[model samples]
Target: MERKKNISMAVIRRLPKYNRYLKELLRTDVDRISSKELGERIGFTASQIRQDLNCFGDFGQQGYGYNVKELLNEINGILGLAKEYKMIIIGAGNIGQAIANYTNFERLAFNLAGIFDVNPKLIGLKIRDVEVKDIDELAGFLKATPIDIGVICVSENSAQTVCDMMVSNGVKGIWNFAPVDLEVPKEIIVENVHLSESLLTLSCLMNDRTYS
Candidate 1:
């Protein structure tokens, strides 16, 4: 496996887009697809697709294009989708509950180990099939459970503290949905998903498209 540090974040980010289109192609029973055909469907140019994929490894033949299922599996492996990652969510709020209810995580090999919150009212509640646990139990829970990822959906004020706790307790990755930016050691892999920022960026692009 190639070291992730050698690849640009730009290439890494486009991986999910490729995976999504490949899955769609599978649903339509498309066995093979050329870069040109995939680009037409996904809005990326053929050259860009080829270049991005080449960074990881050569996946397609010059005349043969790519085997749809084979390419999907390769991309999935590159993205660590084949490994079952156990994750826990902190802050059983609206965003947290929504994440817990997401059915696609299992398909992607990310298992929800537990959900946590400080609220006494939510402690016994269940989101999807996972029971909500008290936030106070998080320290002990991490000791017992082999959690690969910690997801933060808490308010800005509490986000950092929760993240620090997760990291200190041996969590390898973090999927942070909190509004604030977290400061962590270089070793911790963190992906910050700022929903409001994405929506605002979309709104700006839409207005720009309309004006142009």
Candidate 2:
């Protein structure tokens, strides 16, 4: 299973769409589904799906297809969704509050522990049952609580500083929403979500076809 674990990241990324299609099939009582049929639902070719799944052990039979529930569990396990992950948001701004209140993460085994903000007036606020605390308490709170991941939504000016603080607090992974790129130690994993860049790309696509 060395090779399986090696390609696990790519496989995990595709699990959501695969699980979505599998859920639809399960609703129809589809006990077994062929790679071709699964491909049609997600726009992937049969060969591609087979190759990706091949990294893991064979799940499909020679004549029949894969069991719906079995495949769902396998994919979920590979994606680390089989276990819940505790996370905290490091900003109480519009984007941060929206993310904290988002229901999507709940389905994927992620629990929003709390939200932090520098503003005193917003510190005691609640978003989707998760209380907002002062940013000053981040280090202490993290030390006391069980938080594996942190979502950074501070301003661009303070992005690096906030990221540094999070790293110092022993956060393993960070989802950065600031416009500026952050510099972190090699051990920390940082995923930047540049909303403006995505919008600009879409605008360029619509306004000018040259880039496209």
Candidate 3:
């Protein structure tokens, strides 16, 4: 896929949502859908959907809107879902274990290569058949395994160290579930998933609605 220049974060973020909705539509046996119809289902305007998709290239026909299978394939390629990515979790706590157990990752081509933790108790335990290796082995493991993504599920204190270790060992993408912002080179892409922050945001919105 050609690198898209100047794509907004908002648009980049929506691509996955689009892929998800399209997948659901496929399961329903919906072959093709117009922009107006898709917008109604996904909460975006027909014009907005077209504009968002056009950031990469024109995908829909002038009258036909979009072919669901073709559009899904195109979006998959755009999101790098077409390639199988090897990823590992830096911590094997509840969140890390849950993520390792998720079956969706395999469907999306994100192979859980391994899981790691500093706790000796967790080491050698299997979460969904992926053994929790000692965190001390992470460095050596990366040297031999060609992992593309590193998931940081450690505490805030250990997040930076784990992120740095992953980057230094040639991991290009970091999915940080740890609550701290990690400092990495600009070339290394980081997606921070602040679960508490999202929950708090929801709380704030509900509070505002109560006051309104």
Return the TM-score for each candidate structure.
0.94, 0.88, 0.96
Q: Please report how far candidate 3 places residue 61 from its true position, in Å.
A: 1.5
Q: Write the per-residue lDDT of candidate 2 for residues 136-177, one digit (tens) a residue.
A: 888898788867788999998988888887788788899999
Model 3 C-alpha lDDT per residue in residues 3-85, reported as the tens digit of each score: 56999999999999999999999999999999999999999999999889888887878888799999999999999887899
Worst 10-residue lDDT window for candidate 1 reads: 1-10
**Mind sharing the TM-score for model 1?**
0.94
In model 2, which regions exceed 4 Å deviation?
1-12, 204-212
Pick out the ten consecutive residues of candidate 3 with the lowest summed lDDT. 1-10
Better of 2 and 3 by TM-score: 3
Assess candidate 3 and give its lDDT: 0.93
**33: Cα error in model 2, Å:** 0.7
> What's the best-to-worst order under TM-score?
3, 1, 2
Lowest lDDT block of 10, candidate 2: 1-10
Q: Distance (Å) between predicted and true CA of 32, model 2?
A: 1.4
